[model samples]
Target: MTIIATLIVLGVLIFVHELGHFMAARSVGIRVDRFSIGLGPRVWGFRRGDTEYVLSAIPLGGYVKMGGMDDQVMERIEGGAVAEEEDGAAGEGKVQPGRGSADASRTEAVPSAAGRRRDSDFDSKPVWARAWVISAGVIMNMIFAFFAYTAVAAGWGSAQADTTRLGQVVVSFLPEGTEELEGVPEGAHFTRIGDRAVEHWGEVREAILDAPAGPLTFQWDNPRGEITVPMPADAEERRRVVMGLRYWVEPELIFVEPGAPAHRAGVRAGDVVVAVAGERVHLWSQVQDLIRASPGREMEVVVARNGEELSFSVTPSSVDGITPDGEPQTIGQIGVQAQNPPITYTRVAPLEAVQVGWSETVFVTGFILNFLGDLVTGQVSTRNLGSIVTIGEASGQAAAEGLPVFLSFMALFSINLAILNLLPIPILDGGHLVFLGIEAIRGRPVSAEQRMRWSQVGFFILLGIMALALGNDFLRLFGL
Candidate 1:
């Protein structure tokens, strides 16, 4: 299932990216020789007109081959002839087919004008046109991500911003040497903390922040039942009294993986999980633990939706997991996530949805840029880098969760693809843009030998990055 999901996700993203190039080439009158969705030997393909659309064996990346793009190949494509493109030319020229000897002689008598290059050749296009062609792929990916995000937001509705209900309980160590409480489970609602009535998470936060320094009593409604915990008396410990607890907007269904137990049982987004196996729950962690502990066992689930309660019986699925002790273990998984619920949620108008989607895209774009900067500056670890394997695992997990989650993942991947391709490194779209920029400034293209040398360098750099990412994937998967 993970493999399938990964392929689908990657295929869609790669296809959209390549399609952008193909369309731009056609629109700009450049002849595209090949439109491929993968690398390496051709697995399957078909030709249409002048272009061969191929599905290659290596599913890592794809490319669009355009006429006159490769100088060596272009020589053969042009029948051992290279047309001298006239400077400042914009439009395409007509091809005179099947010229007779007499016609050839007559054509030779008329002097060729500057800017009279083949319409279908890549180099014959104006610099701006070429720039657009190189950038089209990134543009398409961004556009695709925006629409996808918009659809997801519109369909699921935005998280209500003013929601005050508790969504999760963050259980952590209270300070050392403090009163050790027992049986304090996560997924509890904060009804009150030290006799301060809590209507919203903000109130809870304020109360915790301003409480007098002393042993404090924390009150919350646990899934099993209502419980109260005595906090540590130490001043520092009292200041951090709410470390193990978190108040959220509302308890809502945030994730449902496709083909997972929850998905199979018809669990969906917007459905508020109220109980697991008849036990009332407030935190997503409680639901996660319950599912994780019940491999292959059917459990009753109750969710609230639109003021109505619905029930489902879900059997947890077996999946590979690692224990805290670094031992391989088979854990039960229902393919759901309850943590990170939105502070507020509500429906949006179509225009609002579009606005939100665009904003999200912009935000993600900035995030990727910042992440890249951090990576280069060593502020972030190389271990954070990932490969196709990582993508596959994540995509598969998201697919199991459900469409909304999967689509959201797809959007993120698309943004990643775009940003990565736009990096100003050799052998990438950004590299080509840099070369073109130099050409525009110098009034001529870089020598083929120079381009070739830089391309090789880029290839080595890319190989190193890929290797590092692969190593990270292996380490992560094996708990090494």
Candidate 2:
């Protein structure tokens, strides 16, 4: 299931990206010789008109072969026989006569514009036309993400944090470093900040930040909770506090992976974990800590199910990982999910749904960009980088949840694909655009030797990044 879902998601995204390039080239009258969905030896294909459509063996990436593009070196990586594209126009330019499809295609060769140097060749096109062809792939990916998000919002509604209570008031997905938000008492929620009643954290932050630099009295729901906060005078500190606040999750199982140790031990979803190894646990973190400390050790687990206590003995799987400070370590996992703070779903009209979709797209785009920046600057851990392995795991988990969940994952992954391709690395759409920019300024394209030199450098950089990501995946899953 995981492999199937990962392939489907990647296949759809890659197809949309390559199709954008193909369409833009065609609209500009650039002759495309081949359209392929993967890189490597051709597994299957058929020629029609001037184009040979192929399904290649390697599924990591794909390409469109255009006339006048000197890609002999690229052929090594793309699975195109060296100089095959140049010979595409020499012979067999027409589809063979057939019963069902002969009428759908031209039976004769397409007329050449002139001996080899045709105006329809990619090199003959102006810089602007070439730029459009290069950029269209990223544009198409972003457009797909927007539509997917809108469809999910309109059909299944948007799910957002319902922070009306104390337990569900986490503000950030992951908090930042060198930051501590003290004096956040548990089991206490803000009844009012100043004279206004506050249910959301946004309201609480606004009231606190807008006030003068002084202690602010906060009214709480509990009788002994009229605590005063010595609000930070620094504006950035005020913002950081708002983002750092979070509550521990409840010790309830929301999911149990089929065939996992927990499931095999008769542990099921909706079970409220009460104790582990004879130690009482109230919060999800505590339950996880106990489990993580006992890898491959049979331990007693007590859960409250339907007002009756149940006991089960389960051993956790151990995997290698890095701690927050970058120390190598091994952690135990049982393939169970704790209930994340509850969410509320609301229906929206067509126009409202469109707005919601666009907003989500923008928000996710910014979030991804920020995380990438942090990862490079060492604010985020390198261990977090993932490859196809992690993606397969996530895809399977989402598929198990439901269609809406899967679609959300698809939308997010689409945006990620678009942004990654736009990085100013060689062999990517952004790299081609950079070359085109130089061509436009110099009134000529870069020499083929220079292009090849830079392209090889870009290829190595990408290879290194992929190796790191795959290593992280092995650490997370197989402890290799």
Candidate 3:
């Protein structure tokens, strides 16, 4: 199921990208020879006017082939324009946009009809037009992402952390030695952190972490008292300090998979898990710890639904899952999802959604660039890189979760594709843009031999990157 979902996502992204080039080419009078949705041999295609649209066998990537894109005729042409018309007399005229090269002398070796080749060739078009044709794919990807994100935001609302009240507060245990845990209560409930009024744990945590070292103020509800504690000034100390304090959250069930233990035991969404195996659980993590420790045991479960507390016997299923650090671990599973209390969502107006969408698109674009910079600086590991396999897994998982999640996943990938294509690498849209920029400045395109050499280098670099990404994917799949 994951594989199929991934393929559908990839296929849609590729089709959208290629469609951009095809539409822009026709609009600008460039003759497109073929528009393929995938690479390798054509599985099926139908000719329409001047272009043949095809579905190729390999679903990895796709391309748009335009008329007169071949190297032979491109090299023979001088000054990047053809003034001669079909009448065989040299006349001053703008190169016709429909064909790649219209001059009979330049395209004689090409087998296309003399009428079709005249003024319709791609190379014959102006440099600006050519650049637009090359950049159309990236533009299309970004537009798709923006619209998709807006629709998801408007339809499902965005997920946000509930931060109105504290769930629980616990002692810090870090650095293998500490004395700060002595004064703190075992389960301190907090209402406010510093001067910030926090309704959600997320807000409180952020406030506390952002506070200047010195002394941090806190207001507790259960104890009905205010306290000021010394806060760590050092970055490492702050990290450990944040980890020492655990926030409280109600383990409210959000999703229950069919045929799973929770569903079989009559558990339903909206049920707040109160106890497991006779042990009261205030936080979701506590529930998880108990369940994982006693996998396969028939345990008594209590959930608060509506105004009544219901009880049931559930035998958890043992499943292979990954830990937070990416290590393989066997864990208990009831096929349920939990969230903190006060899950608030707002139905944003259409215009607001668009604004949010644009902002998100910009964020994703910047994130990709920053990630690439980290990769170059060795701040990030190559193992973090993902290939098609990882994409398939993620997309499939999102699809299984729900429509809104799946759409958001697609939007993210759309942004990624746009940014990646715009990179100034050879064999990409960005590389072609570079050539067009040089042409615009020099008043002529680069020599065919030079372009080909740079393209070859780009191809090898792309191949090496793909190989490394694939290696990472394999390692992850095998749990290495």
Candidate 4:
């Protein structure tokens, strides 16, 4: 399934990119000899007029072949014209049908302008037109990315942190273990921390962290009631208090493994873990910590089911799992998964998709560029770079998890593909555009030797990056 999805995504991206070049070439009156999807041996193909369309065996990358684009090939194709012979034979029939002198006279006639135009046509096109023809592929990829992003944003909505202010007190997703003594519930409006009003989560955390050791007071209100809790006497102990609450964000419970702690404790799909071990549970991290701390220990679990408060005792069990840093650890297992928040779609007028799509396309392009820059500068690690194998693994994991996750993964991969193909290097659309730019400025195309040298360098650089990405993938996959 992962392989299929990856191929489909890559194929669509590549096709859109190639289509850009094809369309631009046709628009500029440049002849395209072939437009191929994929590479290597043709699985299926057909010639239509002057162009041959092909679906190749390898489902990775594609290309467009244009007439007069290659000097040597164009020369051969143009010089091999049998038109003079045919025209001579026709003319000879009028003079003397079977005479050798008739044929000799016909062979001496000048070649038509049409034949010469066909041979030198593409090279004769304006530099600007040629540049556009070469650059169309990258432009199309950008356009595709924009549409895909807009579709996802409009369909699924965007994820953003809540930035609303009420007072000095801020609402939390889950109560910290130390904050548990404060008796704050999830969704509780914190009005004041000690003497200061809390306006944001950051402020709330700061106040908590900087609180005076003795009897720190918190003023809050929940749907049921308002209350205040006092901090402990020990300043160090108070610092250890974990406010496990998260800001209010909609998320679904998507999966529950059979016989797992969550299942055994009667936690089912659609049940929200409102609080765990009396801590307001906001994100997965808080829930995970609670489970990890109480492995094999029974604790009170509070869940919100269809607007009803339900309480159950769950005994967290130890399970073997790999950490993000590639360390094996025994962590508490609940065998539960969360669903992505539901997306609210707003249908727009047809024209809006274009504007929205364009903005999204530019944003994605910029984002990819920034990310690569960061990676190169060591601001981000090489581990963040993923190969096709890593993408497939992610897809498989998401698929095993649920539909929302899978869809999200697909969106990310699509954006990544669009960005990666737009890099200004030889063997890419950007590289071709660079050559075109040189031609436009110099009034002549780049020499084959220069292009070949640059292409070789580009290939080596690309191979190195691929190797690093694949190594990262292997390390992640096998928990190395």
- Which candidate gets the maximum lDDT versus the true structure? 2
Candidate 4, residue 424: how far the Cα is off, in Å:
2.5
Question: Which portions of model 2 miss their true places by more than 4 Å?
Answer: 82-89, 92-116, 161-163, 168-248, 253-280, 285-336, 341-344
Better candidate by TM-score, 1 or 3? 3
Q: What digit string (tens of lDDT, one per residue) describes model 4 on residues 255-350?
A: 775556677778898887778888987565566667876767788888789899889888776544444333445666566777643333445555
TM value for model 1: 0.59
Worst 10-residue lDDT window, candidate 3: 100-109
Candidate 2 per-residue lDDT, tens place, 48-154, comes to: 77887878887887877666554434556665452233445434232211201110000111224344657766767788888888888888888988898899889
Stretches of candidate 4 exceeding 4 Å from the true structure: 70-124, 151-185, 189-221, 224-282, 287-338, 342-359, 393-415
Ranking by TM-score: 2, 3, 1, 4
Q: Choose the strongest candidate by TM-score.
A: 2
For residues 1-480, write the lDDT of model 3, one tens digit per residue. 888889889999998888888788888887766677776555787877766677766787777766666432222221122223687542222233332221111111132344344466677778778777778888899999988888887886654455444443334333233344345554565677787876655566567678886777777665666677777767666566556565556689877755668888899999999999999987887888788866677898899999999999988876554443335556776767786455444567888888878888888888888777766766566767888877987888789867877887888898888888877776678877887788789987777677767766766777898899999777544434
Write the candidate numbers in order of decreasing lDDT.
2, 3, 1, 4
TM-score winner between candidates 1 and 4: 1
- C-alpha local distance difference test of each model: 0.67, 0.71, 0.69, 0.58
